[model samples]
Target: MLPTVRHLLSQPDLDLRLLTPATTLPERALEQSVEWVHSSDLSDPTPFLSPGQVLLTTGTQFDTEAHGDELYTAYVARLRQRGIAALGFGTEVIRDGTPDGLVDACLADGLPLFEVPYRTPFIAVVRSAADMVAEERYARHTWALSAQRAISLAALRPDGLSATLSELSHQLHHWVALFDASGTLDRVFPRDAFAGAGLPGTSFETVQREAGRLLGRGQRASATVLAGGETLTLQTLGRRDQLRGVLALGGVRELDAASQDVVTSVIALAGLALEQNHALAGARGHLRAGLLHALLGGSRDLAETISTEMWGPLPSAPVQLVVTDAPAGRLDAIIEFLELRVEEQPDRLFFATQNDRVVLILDRTGRLLLEDLCRTFGLHAGLSDQTDYRDLPRALAQAEQACERSKEGEAGVVEFDDISRQGVLAFLARTDAREVGRATLLPLINHDELNGSELLKTVQVWLQHNGAFDAAGRVLGVHRHTVRSRIELAETLLGRDLGTFHARADVWAALLATASVPG
Candidate 1:
């Protein structure tokens, strides 16, 4: 609350009189804050003056003998262009009274003009404004300290995170929102702050998109965004390597240094709360994993008792088991999202992690949720057929196998039933049969690697064409005779004849088994 022109004029000791008609000046112009008071006698003082300062000058720059309106107008225009808050003209010093030309310039330019009597020194005005600024600064600093104390107490509440944010919003007289690690809006203070169309210049969706981008980078950072006409500050919470969430303050155009300090304190408190919650979540995750192991070990009754006590009930008996290999970097975020989902529909979904893999047990109706999870996380999953709780071990085995198969496709999720329909070759992908096939094709593999020959590729292509030499040659971009020669050479390396269907079948299986293995 620095002194405004109106405030300065009201001071009895100052005895400043408005030279410009009070009615002619805009109310906002008169109320404009004066950051400092500067007195200059230079003809062009704009170089030393800053915006929002009251410029005081005696009539020394103007020649009293010369009544040139242009000189006064040009001088006033320069001060206006520099954004000087107001002009204070000292009268009875050099000239007899305030110049009528300067008064006319101030009126026409809409600059507030005041007259300082010769009895009052310019230093008195400077010190008066300085004391006012200091008082306001001190008041603001005290408010920040009080606000921080209140917020710290709020963090001691049972719902510390939400309570702290609510207190912060109240203190700032603005809105505050928290976004979880997955970029989901966890909560917003003053709950109805965004209830309807939301406040002007602040769109929750736009803020959320920005938060998502920052969290996706997985680093400790901060961003300031100007939306519509308002300003929003986003600060990442937690450590750089393990960010817990993002804290956003909206409708703040700018914060004074004191306000910024308060916000910093809130960020630290919020981050600590989230970290404590994370540790608790990790403990619960281990418990869930133990239940999953029990379900797979034929202890269905025991697992059900424990799960019912914790998360309502295990997904009803005939449930789908989904498995995915969770990347280490995103594992925490992934778990957090799943935990949120489970909380929303406790009876329909349950998840646990085992050795870098996440296993989900979902009711038949929860398939869509599983699909959404995979799509959102860019994960590949394998879903097992719905099976009774008693046979969860079999379902786990099937889901693990399908998860491996899902990695080879673009669908993101592969079901065990789909693989079963694909016949024996699909199942053989992970079998000991792969070793046998690799053994049978070892000679071709060795020859291709050693001689830079196309024997293995030619054999695979030829078999794919069902033994048609011309078709294989067309695919290999070689002559039919050369294809035949390569196939004959492959037969010699394997000590087998290629004319029979049995030999061709074995070679094709061998090729399929070694398809993913490096040459």
Candidate 2:
């Protein structure tokens, strides 16, 4: 450990005496580390003094009345602001003792002050402090080297990146968390530490947002978020302009050089690990595509063979199928999300893209698991009842129909077993539906488009509520008067009385027909 103010005062050979009593100086201030001892006669020595320094000076310029006591007080205040450990006033300069004004100022400021006898040269003290600092630095360097080796070896273990993170957290005495490219938490050391803490609550969102901005600007970036008075640093992973993830660390103070070295090593190891995982995922994607082609091409034997070889055997006889039609422009993100889930249960879960839809086949019990994943991504999906391996073709068709129906309502999910026979009308092809929809409701749609109106919505709501204006208004969260006016406008544009049975049925079908249109 580096020497402190109290340690220097206790050196009997140097004959140092404390001008400020022990009670006046805080225990923490006495134990504060002193990295170096500096001697100066300049009026403003703050410019030359570094933090954690013990400043030694004589009363050469202080033995006067013209400069005033406030001037000397301000000098001590400046040193304190610069983080000087303590002030040592040498005796036998122009005066045989320390100046009364300086002593009073030091005491008033609560700064640690001591008297250095004339026989003890300032050079001697400087040498002692420098040696102590050197020794501490050497110790830190050795520890850092040993930690780096341990972390590197852990990176090579079966647990790989997880082991590296565990070692890093242990060495640094801080919380560590890693997130993937999707901003999803991948690993955290001391796992339960963030359960009730806000370190990764809102701080994670800020980190991801910062990472996006940094990637756009082609610069490396770090964000410091304070959580419960602890500082959390979020650093971008991967090279500039190609961020792969984010790494976060929480600590009470800034990290020392040794701890920082461990962080850098972890970053490098994580980058390499991420690259390896990416390559492996690509290879697996190719294999999955091949297996999917085999299944769809009606080669059951080969499909079963490949699946059995790569993954475990298919569930005995009864497996469920799930088909998804993601929100526009979010298919890639949804796929990434689902892939991560699949990786968690490689034997029990399998998914691949067929045509424009994502198809998943898992054990019967895992059907609900697929539903949860789709709901998490806000995706529209259709699930089929359990069926044997030979019936996949029919099961897939049912799942596709169910998925198409899912787009008609707010639930964003549908099971073949849940839909009524009449709801089958929702499975009409988009081309045929659009043609009929345009022929029946094109006038109203065009009118609404041109006038920026909610006439169409009013008509749909009115039909949904069995043509009751008050009921529809309540559902629309509007007054009946507004609903009546919009319905009247829609009737005029369509040239039909929506109150009639045939007109009501036709308009309802047309509204359902156009419900699948992309916004």
Candidate 3:
């Protein structure tokens, strides 16, 4: 703390005495902090003085005969306006004692006034105040060093991140909060800090919104805001491009240089802790991916054992698998959210990311949670039908196909059951099925290309006409006999009898599957 007027007067070496009645001084005026002690004798010393400084002067500027009471009163007013912490009048220089007019003016204006004995030189007072300021500065520096060391030790704890935050709050005497990369409040020091402080709810909300804006920019940043009569400082942790989280301090309107050093140390430690956690989370993610691979490869027992040992049980059989193509930027947030859910309901939800897409396996009752995830991230997801663990590979395929189909629909999530209800054509609209259809008709395609015959078209018309030769001929603008001959040629080339219903159905299905392929 800076030296106060009361502290200065209490010093015996300075030999200062209160000129104005002590009781008349404004509330806490005697305790006003003295930044520096400056001696000036100018009639108007306000120009040379700053706020919170002790202004010392000889009585030379005051002339009772020439300026009278008005001069002294105005001088006191000017000093007050300059925010002078206290006024000191050196006696027996140009005048024998402190002027009565000046004392009366100070009393009236509520400015603390003291008399500096002639025995005490102005330089002595200046030196005394300077030494006090220096001592306070040194004390604060020591505190900062000690605080940083404590915070560093806290960072070595098992719960290092949280321990560091708690230590920071203790050192700063302010509440501290940690926000995850997704701008969600992950932890707060002193659980009742905000509530016990009685801060307005909107204040916390404003801080949260500001945290979100900072994380949303995905850059290193800091922000200061005033809410509910308190000051808050927020700093983003980690690198500019890969922000790990945000650290916020409440009740800190500003930080002194020394305090800033302490806070900087805490930020560095917290950032390192978060970086370590991020690396560990990445490793766990890779493990999850490997586990998912094992599940798909039909090693259900091994996958389950590993998963149970690491993160509790996997979702039971008769689970619905969901696959989504969410954007890269939002994938981290999605995974983080799912991880929290998995922690809470380990046996009901599990997720992993592979090939730039997220795969989720949740119990059948988790449809609402899946929907919420899709809606929250604006994701297009394909959900597989409830299936046992043994059929995971088939389920994964179904989910992938449905996910592709979801892109063509308006909904954010589409289930395999919904796709199944569409018809056989919907199921056939896949890469493998399309390739098979193309190969099935390749013989006819090659025969038509080389001979310039209308065999393919004739077969298509005849199929559309439901095997009616007359109807097919009319549509093709050819005689019924010519249409029959073309159909015969198509059958020969296809090596399938068009006379049987099963063969006809197979040919029609192939034709539908390859409908979009260029000839």
Q: In TM-score terms, which candidate is top?
A: 2
Best by lDDT: 1
Clash pairs detected, candidate 1: none
Residues 277-354 of candidate 2: C-alpha lDDT, one tens digit per residue: 767766876787678767766786887777778765544557777888755344445666766665666567777776
Candidate order (lDDT): 1, 3, 2
lDDT tens per residue, model 1, 267-331: 99999999999999889989999999888888988988888898778888689999998987678
> Which runs of model 2 end up more than 4 angstroms from their true locations?
1-17, 21-28, 31-33, 92-97, 197-219, 305-310, 325-347, 354-357, 423-426, 429-519
Writing each residue's lDDT as its tens digit, candidate 3 over 358-413 gives: 99998978899888888887888999999998888899998998899788666588
CA lDDT of each candidate? 0.87, 0.76, 0.85
Winner on lDDT between 1 and 3 is: 1
Better of 1 and 2 by TM-score: 2
lDDT of 2 at 301: 80
Q: What is the lDDT of residue 378 in candidate 3?
A: 80
Q: Which of candidates 2 and 3 is the stronger one according to TM-score?
A: 2
